[model samples]
Target: MSTNPGRVKKDEGFLGKLGGTLARKKRSKEVSDLHEEGKNAINAPLLPSSAELLPEDLLLEENAERSMLDPTSREDPKFKDLQKVLIDWINNELEEDRIIVKDLEEDLYDGQVLQKLFEKLSGRKLNVAEVTQSEIGQKQKLQTVLEAVNELLRPQGWTIEWGVDSIHSKNLVAIVYLLVALAMHYMAPIRLPEHVSVHVVVVKKKEGILQTAQVTKELTTTTEMMMGRFERDAFDTLLDHAPDKLNVVKTSLITFVNKHLNKLNLEVTELESQFADGVYLVLLMGLLEDYFVPLYNFYLTPESFEQKVHNVAFAFELMQDGGLKKPKARPEDVVNLNLKSTLRVLYNLFTNYKSAD
Candidate 1:
């Protein structure tokens, strides 16, 4: 391409740039001057004839209009109001939160009261009741203990018809149910006819490496009742001639469980708890039955301690009667079973008058 030297130089563009630069410089200078004047006004004291410190436009106004003072010199009522309102709001909010927190703490303490009783006992021990057919060549021998259990349960609407091969299994299942009943009440240990743990504790001298018949249970708490124990003598009393008493002892356990469970349903209607409170209650009951029920009647004397636990189920039945009398209906037939409070409160508020020292 041929170079064109005839094109007019762009003097207009250069002039426009120059003009824009000059305009910016003039504005900067004006701003600097105004800043210097404001600095002088602040640094210098007011003169006797000078108007009050105000914008220049205010000084030229009529005398009455001269009340327009420096905006900074006057207090802002709106700002003060906003500050007061904010402080008052904050204080009210803090007070409300404090009340809510106090209420929560009180409720928490109330819920855990009954669980404390688990720790009140001196302690708990293992109670095993086994009947082996091989021990005394009694393979075909009838289980009077099992019969007694069935006899006791029949009146309570539980069926007891086991096959020849299923006899032992049926017996075990029955024992489990009994244990479940025991734990349900263990949550609230009752006052026996005499002052003793309704449960029993079987003791045997250490044969080889075994030292203690004491049994261990899992706990979700660190309360005093967690480690508390019951005396051995109190526990063994249940095994005293249980079979003889089995006929008269009506199993009042099932009715009591049904009543309390129904109450729980009513109380918890539409109410939600952050903790799985209902689940905890059921689990506690299961643990009581599985871990604590059998041992509630642990009984092993120096003589029968070496031999296997015999008449295990019979012993349970015998407990109802004082060995004192033959199986008969109690004078009072209407058994009362009502839980005073929910499981959570029961556990927290759990306190035994006898255990209190």
Candidate 2:
């Protein structure tokens, strides 16, 4: 009752302190609730939104796909050799003319020589026969044609084999082997020639909406029958025998085609079958075209064509029958003697000749 100013001041100070504590606690609770809400929002699932992938992520995906599709990983020695040979050949060309090496992409893309070399190099391996089932069906169609050709040539001291090299699941490259004995003596078979190769590369295009059958741009259409250096007599023998060889192959092909027209079946009845025919014709013609023209330039005179044709006809007739029932006539009597005409005649004969039992 005596006016305690200190006590009042103390009580006032306590009340202020209590109020400050309660207000501070309330502010702390609000802050804590806000922080918890923020945490919840961050942990919540994001709504549907478009976001661009990082460059590294895109690159990683591409690399993974490339690793799956790359053919260089195939563990075949022949494949490795093919790559090596191509590199070597490129080097050689570069040394000879810098201009040739400059357009390596074009060379790889369009060059028949390099394409053929690549094909032959791939052909050296038989593992290509083991392609996946999807490809096997198409491959078998070509295989039948090859078998027919093989049957025709096998009896004539020629060996034929084939292989398949697939490129990135987009193309199938086929190689048909025509192996002939490089006989030093006419009776004895030594080794095979380094360059007596005829490969038919039928490229089945797998890209895009419409798939087609054609020679892939990577395949070489150029024919190569490089008869390396030979002894004078051996050279002459080959030159003289060349016409007979042509006739033999021609007649055999005619017979094979005529006899096996029905035997060769395909799953699809489209031009895919014709693609096989086209490949066959290309390989066959390619083999003869190079040989036919080069023979004249290398060792034949202008006068030789007529005799060559006549001899070929007679030999062919005799080969058909043990006796030469038909008389040997002049080449003029048989047909025209130009390269173009001769090749045409040979092709026509194959397409037109009647098969004998």
On lDDT, the leading prediction is 2
Question: What C-alpha lDDT do the candidate models reach, one value each?
Answer: 0.29, 0.34
Write model 2 residue lDDT over 279-357, tens digit each, in one string.
2222233233222222332222223443434444533343234332332222232332222223333444354333432
lDDT of 1 by residue, 1-357 (tens): 775454424566678899999999999999999999997676443221222333432233232211121222123343233223323322333353342222211221221211112112213211212233352322133243334334545675644433222333222222223322222223322211111111111122222211112222111122112212223331123334464542222222222333344533522222112112233233223333332324334332212311212222222233233232321211111011112112212222122111211
TM-score of each prediction: 0.17, 0.18
lDDT of 1 at 128: 19
- TM-score, candidate 2, is 0.18
In every candidate, how many clashes are there?
39, 0
